[model samples]
Target: MASTQQSRILRVGLLQDGRILEERHLRRPGDLTVGRDAKSTLVLPLSEDLPARFTVFEYRANQYNLVFSAGMKGRVHLGSSDVDFEALRADGMAMQRGHQYVLPLQESARGLVELDGDLSLFFQFVPPPPAAEKPQLPPDLRGGLWRTMDRVFFGILAASLLLHFSGAAIIIASEPPPEPELSLDELPDRFARVLIPPKPEEPKPRAAETAQAAAATEEKPQSNDAQDKPAEATRPANAQEAAARRAEVVKKVEGKGLLKILGSSGSGGGGAFADVLGGSTGGGEIAAALAGAGGVGIATEASVGATGPRGGGTGNVAGIGELGTSGAGKVDLGSSKKEVEVSGRVTSSTPEVESSDVDREALARYVKVRLKAIQNCYEKELKRNPSLKGKVMVRFSILPSGRTGDIEIEENTLGNDAVGSCIRTVIRSWVFPFKPDDEVPVAYPFVFSPAG
Candidate 1:
């Protein structure tokens, strides 16, 4: 191998959520799944109060796999709990054991491996637990001892079941909420009326004056029954008929939640602002929506173009601006006058490290494994035979530490170390997906057949 380093090492790793990853290259996957093996350094919990399933398979003992989600290509600021599984690759500062990485829910989350130098790729997921003896109960227990234990266990289980169902029933039988009790006794002024004295009135001026007075003293209702009586005299009324008329008025404000906010007297900016919230499943009333906005007080069209802070037209604006062939084209949204800046970055879709806190049954993780790339070495062996066609099979173990353990020729239509070594290099360079385990990290065999 010409370019093979003697005592040098390269490492990569990946960590994904609770999911299984199996040894899969462009070859034999067998019973395990071929997970998304991109290189990402940071891994996070599924949620605050849950275990995260992760895999960390390795192609070599020193390296790891990295997996990244979409659009995580910037200065990732994971404050405290953000999981940096491959903190071993920390570049800038020394990683103390007590430090924490908190990942706030971002618009687009990223999985990145921060190493001394940037890596071209990384993946997530590691192997399952290594084989271990299963714990079992002793077989020598006799008669009453076992029977008593069984009975006690059954009793406790039954009690728990009964309690669960009883609680559910109690919740189901809860009564509906009582209706809001209405009382006219302490009702607010908005729902009340007053009386006023009769006065000589002119048709043109008095009619305007009536509305003006109502609009003026509208803020605080007319508490004077005398003043209220005069205002009432101007209105057409009869005792029974007036009661009916009030009912009609009440009906006018029904169905719609119309709130009228009346401001104070002369030049007090008194006005009625109605809030009519529309039910979903239909178009909304623009006027109602506008009323909700402080855009209530009307500005006459004459002053419309003169009062803008931008020294432009007074019409309201929201999203985009003028579509023109480039004159005073678009609104110079504050930042437009500044120089336009361009940005660039590099991202690997591989998984880097996974959280070991929650071990999943079927997820996988990886370790760094370097494949011996013997460039052009295969040409010598193949040229000697001249009949070396088709693929040669190679079998190897993708160590839990992400290194290539065992390597042997599985099949060879025309075998050579050059042929087998090529497959070995690929298997070593590539990552086999695996799940994370809390007890013991498992080891699995990885197989590959090189392209002819």
Candidate 2:
């Protein structure tokens, strides 16, 4: 009973006459010792004649028990012990230690415990009030929720500011870019535009005046110089002489083996031959006449009479080849003549070793390999500016000694000069097949492209 009583709460009240004088809510019932001592639950005045430690009250099942020690000095009275109060007021009581006093019959009442003379302490009994049912928040939890809301609000604000700044920076950086400047090599179109002048507009002529001028020119009399002269006409005697002179010219022409007549013109002819053999004749006219007459040789026989020391006739004209003209001094015009050999000189301007004579696959392979080494230049330039992509046409000459020279940048779409120069330097260091006859010119194209 004592162990169970020590765990429950006890409410003690001290009252005098009717009203409460003092109240205490006790958590530890075992530690409650009322006395004149300073550490007791209810310390009385030293002159009260109470024990150094007085009585204690313990709680059980919603009721309180007053327990007194054997050494208690005061006489603690029970409910309405010496009072003739009303029946309702005769409720609470007090007792000596080592003796248990049940509470008063009434729900609330007081007892007078006499000390000395008229001085006494009154004890009261009262039940604890019902606990309230309203819900409440702890201080720690409320403060934590407020702190969390504050952090979330600040985080959202910071995020919004960062996004706003980022978008602004993007807009600022995205302004229209500057237009590209023209390169030095791009001046050809400008030069052509400036240099080529527009054709002059001609003045329109009056149609009536142009027609009158044409009619006047047509009405003018034509001159006939050939009919005005009689000496220009050919006669039989002059025709014979003209034939002899034409024969001499044919002999010299045949001697060079350049032209050959197919057939003989009749030596005694008198019509077209008469005109051909007449005085007025030119090299072009004679050729035309001979071609028309079928006089060019084709297996016809003729004899060439050579003048020996005795001046004797070597052969008759009829026995000579057809190429030999029938004349007093007959010569063999069909005989083969030796052409002079002019060594060490190229008569034609064309290269002795043309592109067809070169091994194109081998040359292409070599160039492909060299292109890899030279690519470093454009690679570095493209690294700096990836937009660079174009063609480069390099024209270079391979000397007869197999060394590359006369390197030229025929076309370069790349804006940088260093790229072309670097490529030229690499090409100059290249060696090719030795050609003693002619220098080989190589035209190579390079295309540069950057990867995405």
Candidate 3:
């Protein structure tokens, strides 16, 4: 029975606050120590109240014994009843050694020992676990790479490489040879026509010459007419001869009915049918006779030389001089000015600001007002990487003149240098409202998040 009990495994576990912390299985008879020391078999967390080391289970004389100090307390399960340490002491079942208590355990015993009412050690006897089987490779894959690799895969790979190389070689062999290089002398002769410079274009004729050519063509007929006459007779010899020639030309024109059609001799009621032909004094008589005979009556006619209204006669229609003025005054078009409204919003996390000389709140307000520029920097990058969102801390100095200087990114959690650089540039351009007594050092953080 003792051999059989030792053959079975002794499983001991340490638990704290109902949670298992460490567990071990002992196959051979031995002492099990539990404590907060590193050298202990079952080491626990370091605690000032816990002892450095203590034995909880000891195997001797082919029997296991449970051990505990006097202050320790717990219960044990043996046979058919549950027994506490105090009960065991009162029944004289536990052996006292100075301040330690020892209780002999049976092969079937399982119990819990509580240390400081917080740490618990549970021991029980369990069957030994079966041995684990070792993994083994196949016989064919046990040697070198040549034997281990799949034959079909290796063949396919080798064939593919061979086919690629052969195809490349065939292409190289079939390629056409490059053309022979030409010398400079041969090149110039082969492309002589292309290399020759073209001749300069002829300039177009001027406007004056073109006009003279057209005039000469038009005067060709006049020259021909002059040629028909004797050169000496082309012009009249004297004034009387010139007048005589003019009169002859006029007489020939009148003989052709030109003077009669023009009413030059008052034969056709004067030329162009003037009502007062030749300024005749019988105008009223003609008008009255036409009226009495039911013919069209002609109004009193003024002489062509008259400039004003004639006595008892309707004058020529008045000539239009200048346009008359309109009575309307200038119009009022009101104001031409226009008003435009622009609106937008920029969202950002509250800036973590620090300043020595300047008021921290005022500095924060100044940063808040300019957050739009910083937001623009972040949004510009956000368009490229939509998932970009993080914190960027900036450090700058407020000069005595209210201008910013020494602006730089102190910390950047966004991992993007562009945003940090852009923000630094923007902050450098800012001017605080209040001038500091001395240079004020400031560090501000701005958090960015993508808007929904």
- True-vs-predicted CA distance for residue 348, candidate 3, Å: 99
How accurate locally is residue 115 in candidate 2, as Cα lDDT from 0 to 100?
41
| Model 1 misplacement above 4 A | 1-380, 429-452
Greater-lDDT candidate between 1 and 3: 3
lDDT of 2: 0.57
Q: Considering summed lDDT, which 10 consecutive residues are worst modelled in model 2?
A: 342-351
**Model 2 over residues 238-307: C-alpha lDDT tens digits?**
7779877777777677535324332234343433343334422232344455555654443212312133
Candidate lDDT (C-alpha), each: 0.39, 0.57, 0.75
Best-to-worst lDDT order: 3, 2, 1
* Deviation (Å) of 194 in candidate 3: 99
Which ten residues in a row are the worst by lDDT in model 3? 283-292
Q: Write candidate 3's Cα lDDT for 217-313 as tens digits.
A: 9999999988878876778999999867866775576545643464343544433323333344343332222333454333332523453443446
Which number leads on TM-score? 3
Quick one: best lDDT, which candidate?
3
lDDT of model 2, residue 44: 58
What's the alpha carbon RMSD for model 1?
49.7
Question: What TM-scores do the predictions have?
Answer: 0.14, 0.22, 0.31
